[model samples]
Target: MKALRRPSTAVNALLALLIVGAAFWGWTLLKDTDSDTGANASGLRTLTVEQGTVTKTVEADGSVESASTATATFGTAGTVTAIKVKVGDKVTSGQLLARVDDTGAARSLDLAEANLDAAEDALGRAQDAGTDTSSATNEVAQAELAVDEAEAAVAGTKLTAPMAGTVTAVNGTLGGSSSGAEGSGFLDIADLGKLQITAAFSEADATELKEGQAATVTWNALQGAETTGQVVAVDPTATTDDSVVTYGVTVSLPNPPDGAKPGQTVTVSVITGNVENAVLINSAAVTTTGNRHVVTVVGTGNQQETRQVQVGLEGDDAYQITSGLTAGERVVIPTSTTTSSTSNSNNSGPGGFMGGGGGAPPGGR
Candidate 1:
């Protein structure tokens, strides 16, 4: 009597499965509805058509460097006697920047002078001796050579600035000892008035980068200062650093305000493309079904048709459709409901829009 009839486990399991199945079915429907929130929602092989206008642009990065870099060193073998210019000193070309002790050099010069005098006296006496004076004149010439050598040594006692710039570094101190014949620089002089930017671009990006392209640069050193410049040069060879092979792009900075220096960190902006009044299509909407651009165009009848469009330049925010699509055409822009579309970049045809086929519009001016 106490044990009443109870439901079997198999019956309960069947009911549980029906409940779970319904929950999954409802979830799928909710996801599909979320994808279409507006009247002009987008989907695969589709683009939300935008108005048209032309565009111009390029993008790159680089650092600010000196136009002219000069390293001052010991002209002759001697301990550094004095350094006239310190870091940050504005020096002009040919200005004295450093001095090596002339004490030994001057003594050598005196000795040379004495020897020259002795030779002159000997030559004078030899002329008085007569008939044998020819060889004595040769001795005068040899002594004169010694004097010239001594004079040159004395001239090298001072280090002069080779260009108009600021002193950026002082290597060794006076009496600390250093022969600058090696790469060790006694002082560094850099012309900040003429700043240059050394930019690095990937091989793919380098195709868009070229000399004479306009650029804007910014630096942490010069707060609030935006620098304007142009691409001055491009390295023909590729350089590999940190596993990235890049081409060097040199940009000539406009005359910055006084106080610019070399080795300062700088950021450069090279706009790859800039567009105006462009037929703005969300990049996700455009799809490639093999050598063809499949864009969904919505008509006044609310019918969605997959239109074969001849697309053009592709960008981050929009695609440039040269043909196959018109201004104010309603193309469906893809959303989370579908996957992003690919482009037929390698397709060979006049009407084939390839390579993520949205490019900056062509400008007349």
Candidate 2:
């Protein structure tokens, strides 16, 4: 050492002041961090469980089609002389829809009628003269059969509607021979008022659906049109398309949207189950722990305990508590913010707290 010298009074006084200032700053930082930790520890959100309704549903999409449809083809080959009904015309059963050229058929009928009259006269004369009337009788019967055949040929040229429905297609042309080609049908008729949706559901979803179950139908084309319907039929056999197995579930709409035509696509929601007056809680409150449903419940004293629960009728947002939980119980709804804050507090360095274990400041009462 160069010399043993005492520090000046001013220098010693300045060092003392600097040490106190540094200590105060460190104290302020510790107090702030402690306050932050206390606030975060008590900041936990909770939800009160109560009675509510939950509806379990199965959703699928489908297209709307006529419940009953029919296509009328020509019965006989002839020139389409007249087409009485046009597309969209409502027709009744046995209504005359179209007619063909029956001139040749009429002529045959007339010729057959004349031959039958002559044969009857011959039979009457034979009976009056008593000369072998049996042969005349046979000739008259043959003439009667020929007339019936001619009448049938004439009737085959006319086309008629088989049922009462709206005409959807008309493929016949005037003066065109009824060759019955691809475009040769008289017309198509369908019962538009009675509509149905053939919805396809996956194998797992179809199992819960049964005939007579209620369903709701929606179509984008109709602008939020919703109609009540029921499941009319479910195909027992499954249909596979593009490696996906699905089943056809027929839902019938008793009253479809006005002007809703066939082939419009629709979505179907089938209600499988509805639970009422059940204890419900937020779905996030439920957690799976080793084959058990666990939920964290906060007691009156602000203490938390994990308990196993039985859930029923899972809904879109909440779940029904079947057992191990009751109405009016409070359940904890964990949040990311609270979790992050807690993690930061646990990972705090040695300097974070007033003391290592949140002890009082140094030299404090």
Candidate 3:
């Protein structure tokens, strides 16, 4: 039998080179196939026009606050002799909240009263004698004024609830100086039964908000807790912080759920515009050209036409089609193409479609 000859080094090297070339060719074909598949998958996405409700809303961060609040403090400076209520105590208007030493106040009141009595007696005697009583009458009037001031000072020693509310904070302690607490008063009371949300919204958002606009509030502290409210007021003036302008908006929460308290953060979404039973379409399908809006409509036999449309209230995700479109009509969302060549030419380095710095992302309109 003839001995089989082993392959030469040159032949073996050539075979290895051919194998590498075949593998590279297969890889190239596979990459091309994937690119074609991706292009097909991204093409011709369509949405059907339908009759529905479209609501446009403006969202803002806010905090819960009492609609009615009163800060109770002693009008006259003195040591706090009594504290009738503690933090969290419910109180009514005119209810005694705290008391200070009234000794000096009472003495001043008594002295004023005695002076007024003496001055009035003098006036009466002068009048009975038919002599000039102008000076005596003036003295009586001055004394009466002093008496009124003294009475007011006496009443000022006792701090009373100015309105019905729950005591949120007590700054003064028994035996402490009533005047020691400054700025915030001795007691902080808030009408917890009546709550409202105060939010600062951007100038653009505030323009759309008006009194009586319906709103929904969600608490951050309370998981999944939400309630309805109404726009009670919008500030005419703008508040500036770091040169950024915003307006204050107040929303009344007629009936808030339990656990909602003042200072708790909340999210407020006010429905600025709403339309029911209107023809609506995906906002992405509409493109603005100059001053007109247009959409790509797909009809029978896959016929496509670019038609001008009248756009109405634009919502978060849907747009109200005022005209030029009807229910059951299909509209195409233009495909976003980002090939390697295009991406390199645009200098948009990786993550082509989104990172390209193009128009607003899908669903952003």
Candidate 4:
């Protein structure tokens, strides 16, 4: 049998070159893969964990309404006489708001006065007689009673204001009609300065709400300005309107300026409580898993740790981390990080690559 011939040095050199090149190529491919994978796993996430007040507010959108609202209807019934106040008139207590005709009342008053005088004269004469004057005594007593009725009738002819407030509405037009009473007002009065918010909240959500519960208010008319108040009253019964049940909530609003009217809708936000001295963090940093709360933290240089956090309250974009975080420690915002699918190995070569034996074997000799 003939011996196998060995190739020349040039061919040997070329073969060596090919081997080196193959190794380099393999390492390069792995380096790219590792790099890609690492990029996916570890990312730069920016977070905001600072000191701030975290209010647990039950937020709902509603409209602004007059705090001091009133539907003024006269207590005594009468004809629509002369209504002195208009829609925006300010009235003081005891001010004469309107006048009902005193025609019948005046006539009755005059008659009663005459009857009462005649009664007094008969009573004196009967007393002087000092003997069986029972008939005159009875007649005098009847006349005295008639006088009282007449005086009462005249007193019922004037309409007066019951409260010092703004005239929000006027029910009857002057010279329109007349019914007949005293103290019956055709005008509505409301104290705009002492306004209260009457909000219609869903009954289910309003269960925990009670008197003096702190709240914040917003208005469509006044943007960027919020007022604070307390829950003054709550109606337990559900106010159902067309199958939708709601509860009436009264919030004492801040002192308002002059000329405020009722029936305007206002927005109310009931703040149940506040979390103080809490470890606040961006809401985006939080992640949930099967009722567990967690957050991903960026540790020392490309290292990341997942930690469980105790949360107290949640705002629109922030959360109160009651535990698991400290001041000045960094966290991820989740927005700054990007996820990658592939990973690259940067363990071997200069820029990051892989090398020989444990890797894929070359072709057979």
Best by lDDT: 3
Model 4 error, position 212 (Å): 3.7
Candidate 1 lDDT over residue span 68-186, tens digit each: 88988666778787878789999998998777788888999999999889989999998876768777788889889999988888878888888888888888787866464356778
Worst 10 residues of 4 by lDDT: 356-365
List, residue by residue over 44-91, the lDDT tens digit for candidate 3. Answer: 556567666667889999999999998987899888999999989999
By lDDT, is 1 or 4 better? 1
In model 1, which runs have C-alpha deviations exceeding 4 angstroms? 1-38, 41-47, 52-61, 110-146, 178-182, 220-225, 255-261, 272-280, 289-291, 335-365
Global lDDT of each candidate: 0.68, 0.76, 0.80, 0.62
In angstroms, how far off is 56's CA in candidate 2?
1.0
Clashes (N, CA, C under 3 Å) per candidate: 15, 0, 0, 31
Cα RMSD, each candidate: 10.6, 13.2, 9.0, 14.8
Rank candidates, lDDT, best first. Answer: 3, 2, 1, 4
Candidate with better lDDT, 2 vs 4: 2
Give lDDT tens digits, candidate 4, residues 1-365. 12333456667899999999999999888777644333223544344355555555555555445555444554334555677778789988888777767777788789888887887788788789796677878887888788777777666566677778888767676665444223543566777677777788886668768888888777656556667888888886777899988888888877543443355556788866565555565455577677678877666675667888887777533567778887545555444322210111112211111111112111100
Q: Score residue 338 of candidate 2 by CA lDDT.
A: 41
User: Which regions of candidate 4 deviate over 4 angstroms?
Assistant: 1-52, 61-81, 131-146, 179-185, 223-225, 255-261, 280-311, 314-365
